[model samples]
Target: MSLLAQLKILVVDDTTTSRLLLRDALETIGFRNISVAANGEEAMKMMTTSPCHFIISDMNMPKMDGLQLLKAVRTHKVFARTPFMILTGNADRNVLEEGRKLGLNNYLNKPFTPEDLKKALEAVVGRLQ
Candidate 1:
C-alpha cells in the first residue's frame, strides 16, 4: 500500500457535519486510515487506544476543546511528536495562542475546500502524494 494509505489520521469535532466534511476531504486526498471523534475527551481516548500519525481537530468542543487535547497530546511523551493541526471555525486569537503554546503544528479555518485542506495538510506534514 501507498504510505498515505497507512498514515493514520484522527479527526476531532463536535459537529458531525464538520467531522464528515474533514473525513471526506481527507479521503478525497487519498487518505484511507481515518477516524473521527466528537469531542476532545473522546479523541484522547481514541488516541491512546489507537494512536494516529496526524490529528485534525476543532478548537471548540464540549468536555474538552482542541487546545486541551493538544496540551494532553504534547505533554504525553508517547504522542508528543505527533503532528497536530486545528481545523476550526473559531477566530479567537486567544484560543489560537493557547494552541500555539501547546505545540500546534498548524491550523486551517472552516468553510475550506478540498484544495485548501490539501494545502493545509501539506503545510503541516509536507506534500501528501
Candidate 2:
C-alpha cells in the first residue's frame, strides 16, 4: 500500500487557498482520507465527531488558534497521542518553542513545497509502521 493510504489527515487553515493546496498535495501523495477545517473551532468540532490520525494546522486563525486546538486535543483522552504538525508564517522563535512544548510533531514554515509536506508526514507516520 502507498504510505498515505487510509491515513486520515485534518488540515486546518483560515485561508481557503492554503487548505486547498495542502489537500491537493496530500492527494498527490496518495492520501485518500483528508478533511479540511477553516479555523480551529471547526477543527475541534470535527475532531470530536470524526477523529483523524494526523493534523496539519496554521498557528494564526480566527475563532481558535493552532495552540489552543493543540491544547484541546492534548486534553482529550482520545486524541492525546494524535500526530499534529504546524504550517505557519510565524518566524518567532518563542512561538515555535511554545508550539514545541505543546507536543507538535513538526513545524513547517509557510510557502512549503509538496516535498516538505511529504517529508513531515514521513517523519510522523513512517515510525509507526
TM-score versus the correct structure, for each prediction = 0.94, 0.93
Worst 10 residues of 2 by lDDT: 120-129
Runs in model 1 lying further than 4 Å from the true structure? none
Best by the TM-score measure: 1
Q: Pick by lDDT: which candidate is best? A: 1
lDDT scores in order: 0.89, 0.86
The TM-score obtained by model 1 is 0.94
lDDT of 1 at 29: 90
Among all windows of 10 consecutive residues in model 1, the one with the lowest summed lDDT is: 87-96
* Cα TM-score of candidate 2: 0.93
| C-alpha root-mean-square deviation, candidate 1 | 1.1
Evaluated against the true structure, the overall lDDT of model 2 is: 0.86
Which residues of candidate 2, in runs, are more than 4 Å off?
Answer: 127-129
